[model samples]
Target chain A: MTTSSYVYYPGCALQHRSHAYEVSNQAVAKALGIELVELDDWNCCGATEYFSVKRLPAYALVARNLALAAQAGTEELVVPCSACFLNLHKTDSHMRQHPRLEQAVNEALEAGDLHYKPGSVRVRHLVEVIINDIGFERLGQLVRRPLYGLKLAAYYGCLIVRPDNVLDDVEQPMLLDRMIEALGAEAAPFSMKTACCGGHMTQISETTALEMIHRLVTNASVSEADAMVTICPMCQLNLDVYQDAANRMFETSYTMPVLFFTQVIGLALGLSLEALGFGQEFVSVEPLIEKIRDVPPARSKPERRPKQALPMPAMPQ
Target chain B: MNATRPPTFFDRVVAATPDGERLSQCLQCGTCGGSCPSAADMDYTPRELFAMTMAGLEEEVLASNTPWFCVSCYACTVRCPQEIPITDLMYTFKQMAIEAKRFEHRSTADWSESFVGFVEQRGRSFELGLATRYHLFHHPAQVFKMGALGLNMLRHNRLALRPKSIRGIEQLRAILDRAKVLAEKEAWR
Candidate 1:
């Protein structure tokens, strides 16, 4: 591992709607001998919406957390949530790129008696640290129970890999695939791996969001994957919470359980179900749990996505 | 710092954002429009929005539901051949529409407004509270539609009634206040 420990930022979602992600993440990290020191007094990331309403205040809102993380004096600040990671990474990049933004942001920070220098702290997604710093070999070694029979579809939601994709390829990222493989599961083929999960559109326009959700769930269902593994809380929430809504809208039944990569990793590392918060999912992973505990999926030839008439976009190495 | 509204909506948007000035580099490739998942529901596709922006349709651009409809998935911004920060541009447009108070999709705009208000007030979001306020004021029908889902989440403890305030909420408020001042000072009048 690059370093044994780093500062961790679990944004608001983790505290409420996505607490399971935090639970599983911490369990998995502990199992792997990683020390995640939570950031002190971090505020919301303003998510994807606030920035649109008040640009400067939103930057300050996102920047405040960075400023706090910088105070921790850790070289690496890890964020689990995709939105938080992007906000912090984007702020760091935007600040470094635009000195004026940095200056204005710092000026606001000064009001709270906080100081931050842009680019001083390395902002990273949690999965990147696990895959890169922790190394897949080491990760695979820590797999005590091995996710033997699970056919997993890795869903890399949009924020983590876009415009400035730091962790994975811009289009067809495979970091999640590699991480899932390290956990000893078959990384099932999924075409909508990098597709947007309609994000907050689920709240804005239900019909449109449901359509987008239907596409992702249908594609995953078509793949016959046991469950779709995700890194983002929003992606997991949208997929997990809105299955009924999606089914009602599209008249298609999709029972694909959306599990966080950490949750699955925790299971592979032999963490308890309660510790991993498995039962918290809206779409019960009970059937998948039966597979994990009693009868795991064998390495049988799982169903694959039919060859697309249109070729998928290529990713960088 | 002062009222310097550029004649064109595109120009105003570009001028408003320090980083989004690159919209002029657009190739009209329709990559943004094509990549957008919600484009079918939009009145003006991202490409058309850009065209209208460049055509100096100030009021039309400000009032267009395109910005409100944007889910900020960043799909268009990611695939833009010109490397334009289309998502951020959408944000810039959203702020402009809020200031102009002429949103085509008033309910959607109001939803975003209520959310932002929730975050600013408590330094965190209370999803249940925000939804109730927004639905009751804007689209009361949605409340009933989402009632079961809301109840389920509440029962599961996924949704919380009490808001979670950050430890140094006072500091957070101070930062937000200062930022608001800076934004007002720096925002194009």
Candidate 2:
């Protein structure tokens, strides 16, 4: 379940916004005996918009990270943030397919006195690496305090399992499901699991993003999930930062705490809340932690399927 | 400016895109439109936008918020039966809008500009810097509104008040510049 080496790229979000994901990721990795070396001189992956506005600059920006990871002399680079993972992985795939893009990206890199080859370094998300390299069997072995009473909705957001995927099915991935099960927490039915979290749309148009977040938060709550576990910072940010805004917009109050997948892993390993970087969210985890601590471990109560259940409600216009 | 010029919107988009010809293959089915979370907000659903582009309604398409309304979620791109990279196609429309200077989605456009500028200048994003720039150009009043949220992030160490830049920033700037020049010469425009 342990590997000798893999490089890590925390991306822009982890440096600040999702610092907890970074901390908990490293803690979980260290406990699992895999040391993740940070990539040197990495730059932002252009996040969501740059690539759309200016094609060449975005590719060049992402390529810089790839070139550095390759320079670090590792075949596999593990990314904790899904946006970073997608940027790195998608760039490598594009470079391999389109000679023009490859030439342009590489030419841009030459200015930095750096160059990258297509497919030289493999990019894997931390969750995928955990589920694959460090098998769930060993991951389960590390759990000191099993999350017996917690229920989680594995939120994949838009980037992680998307246009280019290898770890799991694009629409209905089970990697996180298995992980939650291993830690003894129930993987609640996440019907809207693969839906978009509005990404940076919340920054530009809160009205539209609020609608999207409201759907996701409401769905998770209806499923009786305790927390929504996510693999991307953008998803966590939108869900947490805009929870109250969403509730206000929809005239519905829903409290659902979003946690990075690694945070859940850290909790299962019995690491301190401080070590996992908990209590740093807009929608506080304080109540959820208390509930988990005060309650005895209980089996997940599955929602009973109703016979001839009323038809699904139509989407609001 | 060039009323006498040839009708070239489709040809230009095709030449610029990796699979521009695929745009012609759209089944007129509303899968992209249906799957889009922001479709209700868009002036034209991606389906309608694609149709407009094919119809050579360049001015309307360029000025419309259809492209900017896209959050780049890729639900359409993933679910498209024709395997169209609809999101990237939307991105193409966004770039065209920016280049044409006919875009009306001021707030989104400002954010995109600020985001790209932040990446270019610091070799990484300064979250506060990006937000401040966006607010200045788009909605200065919202800056005060965001104070409480900003304080929460600041308290949690989610944002650093002073940006810590990455090493080799000059090289990053050079790469972006050179790539711009090279892309300009790609024979698409």
Candidate 3:
């Protein structure tokens, strides 16, 4: 059964680097009659780097958040960041899958006088809860202002739908597409919808990371999307902030606005731009905001050449 | 002719990873290699890396940049017909490489260390600190290049100048300390 209330785990990046996501997410949640209780004293989920550094310690670190969420008395723990969601969900399942790991992690948890069962608190991404719990039907009804004439490409970064195809189809997820359509926007056909955003590769390998980012933006441009709506901070940061770097490296001119899905949802809910953390983005979404219409575009047939008219002859050289 | 020989590098990797025995089931299929977005940048495709590991090429495997170039997108793991957990094995390989001090790129190691350092210090990661320290240590020239981006983040209020410590920091530290001991007991290093 889906619940209206959930324990929120705003991972470190969300609290600082992705504060806009947190603000817009909270506003959208409140408007939808969903209560998100912040898990008390929540620490880092160790991200991806920690696991590569220390495996057992990293599991224990992520399990700490799970232990806290379990103690918070909420049956579901909703996370905003894709990396955080993956770490929390992966650790929980790993503990259940491996007894030795479960015992070791539990022993570490004993230091804080906390213990967590693998399935005590269900780990979910914020997008998952919004799509599954409040649902598109209610979301459509709650749209105070439909975002018409706005072409949006739903970009789902790597971690959200991988390792386990729990949330959506691994190859071609439709939840993001459906949600965008529910917002009264055209969901452009994006081929690189589930491509990697290079994560920390930007810091690790500049050339390789920029090439990946270039592919994403170039694809979105080909689709003629007004903006690319993303569900993860790292994706947004890479596509928005590092876009200039990619342009410089590739010598291509591409202006694609990357935004958090919550911000887009907030706009549909009639929330103000400032309230939705609009200005926090590196790429200006102002032009795109002006494109939203009050009503959907009229359905009219495309103009065709006159039946009697002959095709234009090629100009003489 | 000996029936009992020491565990090969492949055996060590399989043993280190949870449910990693599936590594033996790898069909040398190119699904993982084809699915990887950064495979072009990798010195060896994941399939070739696996075969090399089975041949006990520890030095070449550890020093290769394939694992570090991985974005951890798990495109390979979810699609692996053998369910070999290719991504998890990547993580294991990264850890082993770190232990061997065979980092093909020093910046990758420094980046992870700084990230883990901040997490240990304040119970949460400080992005600004992590970035500043990493850039200053590894690529000082790139620091100036990233100056505008950093300032832009600051202007937008996305970058926090100060790190915030969680209320249960002491408890968190104790937990990490215990976990470290347990990790050592596992003999990972």
Candidate 4:
């Protein structure tokens, strides 16, 4: 945890479908002086679908990555994709909890001449690394081009902070919001922040997925956020790629721009658009970029509470 | 003379789940169902499904579309008062339904198989291959509908046309094969 360097595990989706996230993450990391060493010869972590079909094999698949990371001798393994992060984290945690499963997985690993001790290497999400390792004070000082007038809705699709609230609150995560604010952008009140974007249901059950996507876009639209920022590639893909399909299915004219948190951070860091991989988004961010003001707008006045209204319960510490 | 009932479906599920002893502690609360984003799409709510499982309604439970609709967001799993690992149980039900050939939805299973097929062959997932193979086999009409999106991805250089194999794919294959054997042995046990 002391080292600013980590073994980077860019899951398959980030390598193929979400290059914007990869480049921006790297650019941001470099600017922050954090060293990211890519894990060599890594394979798929089976995502969510693999575990459903075969449980033991899925653990072994993710364990292979852990083994490789351990072999690389890095204390921390930074994974960008939410699904990959969850799979790797869950595998390690479960291996520690269930000795039988660990024994079974290690038996499989014997074939590859690799073995991993549970908890040998820590699995972390990239956002957590950037936020925790390099605090907001450092990020605020480093911001060259503040995203002043932009209103961003932080979308933390399920996997990153669930099944074990590894990073933030399960129902209401604010790390993304805090990051948005740290970048000098307004964090919109998006209630459906933790809502599911239907994962691969777009392929399996199109009707249901479209409806789910429609709801998410509709929430951001109602909130009047300029764009929705996300950490998971699947969330971005669902909201960005299938936006048109959702629009057609719902007959709504919502044009919310979905972006990766890294891309937004890169913008605030004053990096060139090309360096941040901006042009690759299905929804063009050019118009959103135009809305960036040189300085943040004046803070809006807080609404006065009603005399009869009861005090809201304090959030758990 | 003595009479005894067979092991319930609940018993089978609990036995299969790694930490499934907690399943018996389910409060019958609808939190899982209420928290589920796709609960409306499920034939039976998670609470109802749990009751049905304990009642030994194996065929009906397997045939239900409840498990297929789960997106694995894990909202229900975290919120479950009983901490029943509700999401993992969904995976179990999906596997069981697929093995029994009792699942109502074919396209979901097909998509999963196609995804795993790519992973197995190349040690990585090929989104382009998964999309083409799945849409072509299941919804040929939707291919034309999704053509522009596919072209858009290619235009942005986001979609890789070719699948890349890892150098240690042979090692990966050996590990996966051994894992498969272990899974089968566990199932038989």
Q: lDDT, candidate 2, residue A119?
A: 93
For residue B152, what is the lDDT in candidate 2?
Answer: 77
DockQ (C-alpha based) per candidate is: 0.69, 0.67, 0.76, 0.71
Top-DockQ structure, candidate number: 3
Quantify all predictions' global Cα lDDT against the true fold.
Answer: 0.83, 0.84, 0.89, 0.89
Tens digits of per-residue lDDT for model 4, A1-317: 24467799999988878998999888888888887888999999988888777788888989999999999888789999999999999999989998888899999999999999998999999999989989888899999999999999999999999877889999889988998999999999999999999999888788899999999999998888999999999999999988988888889887788988888998999999999888777777889999999977997876987889798899999
TM-score of each: 0.92, 0.93, 0.94, 0.95
Q: Poorest 10 consecutive residues of model 4 chain B by lDDT?
A: B1-10
State which candidate, 2 or 3, has the greater TM-score: 3
TM-score of 3: 0.94
What TM-score applies to chain A of candidate 2?
0.91
Candidate 2 regions off by >4 Å? A1-3, A293-317, B1-7, B187-189
Kindly indicate the candidate among 2 and 4 with the higher DockQ.
Answer: 4
The sequence of per-residue lDDT tens digits that candidate 1 reaches over residues A24-63 is 9888888877889899888889887788778888888888
Off by over 4 Å in 1: A1-3, A292-317, B1-7, B187-189
Fnat: each model in turn? 0.79, 0.73, 0.85, 0.79
